[model samples]
Target: MTHRLPVRVYYEDTDMGGIVYYANYLKYIERSRSTLVGELGLDQKKMKDEDAIVFVVVRVEADYLRPARLDDELEIVTTHHAASPMRWVFDQDVMRGDELLFRAKVTAVCMTTEGKPVRLPAELRAKLT
Candidate 1:
């Protein structure tokens, strides 16, 4: 399944040249992943507070294909799949209408707040698959 999130390129998202800062694309994709988790009925806060479990990004591979300027309306498209019991992978794209601006593959691992890796909760794993 795929998830879509709409985002607007605001003044704060841009650099001195008025184009989105490269780092901001990572932020945009992070928001898309967070939203996807919420839509899947996962409560990150609850997981953190009660189970002491949290998801942390372990790696990100990105490519910049085009630039996005301030005031541009963009959509983040994300598709997720499980990589292992403790790892989840997401492929994301940043688009302005039909134009692909950026793409990334992000890997996240389930971990304890103290930083030890852990298998994803059974319920959450079921939801992702």
Candidate 2:
């Protein structure tokens, strides 16, 4: 399944050239990933507090294909699958209408609050796959 989130660029998101700053694309996709987790019935805070498990980004590979300007309406599209017992991989895109502006592959792993790697909870693993 793919999750979609709508975002609007503001003055703060732009650079001196009036286009989005390159790093902001990562923020956009991160929000979409958070939203996806919520929509999937997973409560991150609960997981961390009750189960002592938290998710952390292990890697990100991104490509910028186009620029987004202030006031532009953009959509973030995200899809995910399990990479292993401890890791989940997400493929994401930043789009303006039908135009693809950016794409990324993000890898995340489940970890204990003390920073030790841990296997994903069975419930989350099932949801991700």
Candidate 3:
């Protein structure tokens, strides 16, 4: 399944050149992932409070194919690419209309509050699939 979230680039998201700062794409995809989980009915706060599990980004591989400027309305698309016992890999993309501006493979791991890696709960994995 793919989850899409809309984002409007603001002045703060731009660099001195008036193009979106590279780092802001990371923030955009991160927010999209959060919304994706919520739409999947995975309440992260409740998971942390009740089950002691929280998700953390472990790695990211991104490619910037095109630049987005201030006021550009973009769409962030997120989908599960793969999953292991301890991590889920997501393929996320930033698009403006039919143009692909950026893409990334983000790996996130579930961990205990103490910060040890943990297997994703079976129920949550099922929900993701």
Instruction: State TM-scores per candidate.
Output: 0.97, 0.96, 0.94
Which residues of candidate 2, in runs, are more than 4 Å off? Answer: none
Q: Write the per-residue lDDT of candidate 2 for residues 25-49, one digit (tens) a residue.
A: 9999999999999998999999999
**Residue lDDT tens for model 1, 16-105:** 999999999999999999999998899999999999999999999999999999999999999998889989999999999999999999
Runs in model 3 with CA error above 4 Å?
none
Rank list by lDDT: 1, 2, 3
Worst 10 residues of 3 by lDDT: 78-87
Runs in model 1 deviating more than 4 A are none
TM-score-best of 2 and 3: 2
lDDT of each: 0.95, 0.95, 0.92
Q: Report the C-alpha displacement of residue 1, candidate 3, in angstroms.
A: 1.2
For candidate 2, which ten residues in a row score worst on lDDT? 120-129
